[model samples]
Target: MTFKPLLQHFKEMKHYFIVVVLVFGVSFYLGWANSEQFSHFLKDQLEGLKSLSQSLSNKDNPQMWFFFIIFLNNAVKSVAIIFLGLPLGILPLFMLVANGMILGYVLSLQTHESTLSIVLKGILPHGIIEIPVILLACAYGLKLGMLVWKSAAQIFVPVANRTASAELKKVLTLTKPLIVIIVVLLLLAAIIESTLTYWLVHL
Candidate 1:
């Protein structure tokens, strides 16, 4: 799409972006503070994925599988946030909190220096793009939830029906571009994560 529309989209979604960031920050801090607890929680959750993770990790040329897995995971999450926002936006917020807490809990296990090094060498390469895409998806998801609320609240008012219809149309129009951007960024992130991130951490 054109730069103007993209820029406009960013401006419109700025507030939601900030909200997502704040939510993430608070959850991250909580996770860090209760690292031991979250650690146990995460471990239990991860237990089911251990075999899958191990299998992926053992590949001699894991990049293909890594990219496929990461891309699929991100795509599913983005779709969930966007579509599931109709349920009062709770799903999108849950995603932000869950990811933030896991990230914080995992980081807390590392030494300060190691954490810094990891952030710089491992996360930054792909995270720069991936994080924003995630936040944008969440912001749009929250926006969708707001739209649903607005439509529901004005359901009884005849005049409000037209307004609600317009709003729904607007949301649908905006979501198309958002989904496209998210897909592109996630693809890039998958590539970098499979290559640059892998090499950096292994080094």
Candidate 2:
């Protein structure tokens, strides 16, 4: 499938992307600043992720299973954020904050030099691709949330069923392709994470 339109769409939503990034950055700073205080809390809140990271790190043959687990986790998370944005986008924003908090907390556990090493070796391989995909998903989710709000506002006015249906169709038409692209990108990211990132970090 052609990704030109999808890329263009993401470019158009630059404001949403910036907002999501800023929110993540703010939360990340908070987590980093209070690393000691937040460490236990983050560990408790992200037990599953901790377990998964441990499993991935400890495994010798982490190829197939690693790919499967990471892919499923990311796919579910991305889909959840996008769909849950239906509630005026609050859920997506929360998801972004949660992610930033987790990242910052985890990174803060290391010394500055170690943190740089970890990011360069452990995260950057797949992160280069994965991060942008996530931002795009968040942007689309926010857009969907705004659409939901607009549709809700339309309820107060008299709108024809046919017109609403057409509008919905237009939305679906735009959303479906974007979802496909996100899924594809996530799949590639999972592959890179399981293979290249796994190797680099272990080395």
Clash counts per candidate, in order, are: 0, 0
Q: What is the TM-score of each candidate against the true structure?
A: 0.89, 0.85
Per-residue lDDT tens digits for candidate 1, residues 98-167, read 8788778767878987999978887899989888788778887888888788787777665624576576
Worst 10 residues of 2 by lDDT: 162-171
Error of 1 at 81 (Å): 1.4
Runs of candidate 1 with Cα error greater than 4 angstroms are 1-6, 48-50, 157-162
Q: Give the TM-score of candidate 1.
A: 0.89
Candidate 1 at 64: error in angstroms? 1.5
**Lowest lDDT block of 10, candidate 1:** 156-165
**What do the candidate models score in CA lDDT, each in turn?**
0.81, 0.79
**Model 2, range 11-130, lDDT digits (tens) per residue?**
667889899889889989978888777777788877987687778767787687889898888888886788778788898888787878888887888898799999998788888888
